[model samples]
Target: MIVAVRRSLRRALLVAGRDLTVERRQPDGLVAALTFTVTLIFVESLAVGPVEARRPVIAAALFWIALLFAAILGATRSLERELEDDALDGILLLAGGRDALFAGKTLALAATLGIVALAGGSLALVLFDLTVALPFHLVLGVALGVIALPPVVVLDTLLALRLRARALLVPILALPVLVPQLVAATQGTAAALSGDAAASLGWSGMLLAFAIAYTGIGLTIVPAAIE
Candidate 1:
C-alpha cells in the first residue's frame, strides 16, 4: 500500500510538471486568469464605492470573489487544452489511473490559481489600503484558500466538459460547492486584518478541512467520472 501510494504521488508530480510546462510555454490560461481577476477586483471595488471598499471585510470578500472565478477560468482552460486532438485520453491511459490524473490536475490547477490569489490579494491591499494586523493569519488564510480551490475546480471542470453546455455549466456547478471555502477565506482575511487571531485560525482550519474533503471526493469519483 505504501509503495502504491508513493508510485501514485510520483506519477502525480510528473503529470503536474507536464501541465506546468505546457502552461509556461503557451500561457494562455494564466494570462487570461490574471487579467480577468485583476479586472474583477478593480471593478468590484468601484461598485462598492470608496468608503465601503476600504473596509477589510468588504475588500476581502471582493478579492475572494474575483479569485474564485479566476480559478474556474484557469481550470477550464487547462482541461480544455487537453481535449484538443484527444490528448487527454492519451494522458489518462498513461497516468497509471484516474486518481493520479486527478491529483496531477488538481496540483496544476492549484499552482495556477495560487498566482491569481496572490495578485488579487496584493491588489486588495493596495486598493483598500488594507493593513494586516496579523500577517501570519492573513498569509495562512491565503495559503489555505489556494490549497482548497483546485480540487473542486478540477472536478467540476471534468464534469462540465462531459456535458454539452460546459461553458455555462461550470460556474453553475462549481459556485454552490465553492461557497463554504469562499466564506471561510473571506472571513479569515477580514479577521487577520482586524487582528482576530482566533477567528483567522478557525477559518483557516475550515479551508484546510474543505481541501482535504473535496480532494478525497475527487480521487474517489474521478475514475468513474472520466469514463
Candidate 2:
C-alpha cells in the first residue's frame, strides 16, 4: 500500500511538473496575471489615496480580489493550454484515474496561485506602505487566504472546461462561491491591521473551516469533472 501510494504521488507530481514546465516555456499566463494584479493594486491605491488610511479595510479586499481574478485567469489559461495542445485527452488516457489527474492539476493550480499571491502581497505592502499592527496575524491571515484559494480555483477550472462564455462564467460562478473565504480573509486582515489578535484568530478559524470544507468537496467533485 505504501509503494502504491508513493507511485500515485509520483505520477501526480509528474503531471504537475509538466504543467509547470509548460508555463515556464511560454510564461505569458504568469506575466498576464502579475500585470493584472499590479495594475489593479495601482488603481485601488490611487483611488484610496494612501495605504495608511485605507489599509485596514482595503488591504484584505484588495488581496483577495486580485488573487480571485488572477486565479480565474490563470486557471482558465492553464486548462485551455492543455486543451489547445490536445494534451488533456492524452493525459486522461494515460492516467487511468480521474482522481489522480485532479490531484495533479489541483496541485499545479495551487502552486501557481501561491506564486501570484506572494508577488501581489509583497507589492501591495510596499506600494501601499501598509503599517498594520500584529504583523504575525497579518501574515497569518494572508497565508490562510493563499492556502484557501487554489482548490476553489481548481474546482472553477473544472467547471469552466467546455463551457460557453467561460471567462465571464468563471467569475460569476466562482466569486459567489468564494464569498465565505473572502469574508473570513477580509475580517482577519482587518483585525490584524488594527492589532486585534482575538478578532484575527476568530476570522482565521473561520477561514480554516472554509478551507477544510472546500478541500473535502473538491476532492470528491473534481475527480468526476476530470473524467
Candidate 3:
C-alpha cells in the first residue's frame, strides 16, 4: 500500500512537473495572474482608503474575490494552454488513467493558487492594515481555502476546455459552482477577523467537505471529458 501510494504520488508529481516546466518556459501565465491580483487589491485599497479597507467585513469579501478571480484566470489559462498544444490529450493517453491526469492537473493548479493566495493575503495585510486577533484561525482559514482550489479548478477546467467562449464560460460555470467555497472562505475569514473560533471551525468543516465532494466528482467526470 505504501509503495502504491508512493507510485501514485510520483505519477501525479510527474504530471505536475510537466506543468511547472511549461510555466517556467513561458512565464506569462504566472505574471498575468499575479499582476491581476495585485492590481485589484491596490485599486480596492485606493478606492476604499486604507483606513476603511481595514474593516473586517469588507476585507474578507475583498480577499475572497481577489483570490477567486485570480484563480479563475490562472486555471483557465493553464487548461487552455494544454488544449491549445493538444498536450492534455497526450497526457491522457500517456498517463493511462484519467483520474491520475485530473489529480496531477488539479495539484498543479492548486499549487499555483496557493502561491497567489499567499501573495494576496500578504498584500491585504499590508495595504489594508487588517487586524485580526485570531492569527491561528486566520491562517487556518486561508490554508483550507487554498486546499479547496484543486478540485474546483479540475472541474472548471474540464468544463471550459471545449467551450467556445471560455473566458465568459469559465466565470459563469465556476462562480456558481464555487459559491459554497467562497461563502465558507469568507465566513471563516470573517470569523477569524472577529476572533471567533467556533465560527471559523464550522466553516472549515464545510470547506473540507466541499473539497472532498468536488474532487470526487471531478475525478469521476474526467474520464468522460478526456474521451
Instruction: Please name the candidate that would achieve the greatest lDDT relative to the true structure.
Output: 1
Error of 2 at 225 (Å): 3.1
Provide the lDDT at 149 for model 3. 64
Clash list (residue pairs), candidate 3: none
- lDDT by residue (tens digit), candidate 3, 1-227: 99976877788788878887887798777778888888898888788887777888678878888888887887777887887868777777864457777777778877888888889889888888777889999888888897786688667767667777878887887888888899899999989998989999899888888888888898778778756
Q: For each candidate in the order shown, give its overall lDDT on alpha carbons.
A: 0.90, 0.78, 0.81
Cand. 3 Cα-lDDT: 0.81
* Residue 142 lDDT in candidate 1: 93
TM-score of each: 0.97, 0.88, 0.91
**Sliding window of 10 residues with minimal summed lDDT for model 3:** 94-103
lDDT of 1 by residue, 60-93 (tens): 9999999899889988888888888978888778
lDDT of 2 by residue, 174-218 (tens): 888988888888889889988999999989888778777887787
Which has the better lDDT: candidate 2, or candidate 3?
3
Q: Which stretches of candidate 1 lie over 4 Å from their true place?
A: none
Query: What is the alpha-carbon lDDT of model 2 when measured against the actual structure?
Result: 0.78
Candidates 1 and 3 compared: the better one by TM-score is 1
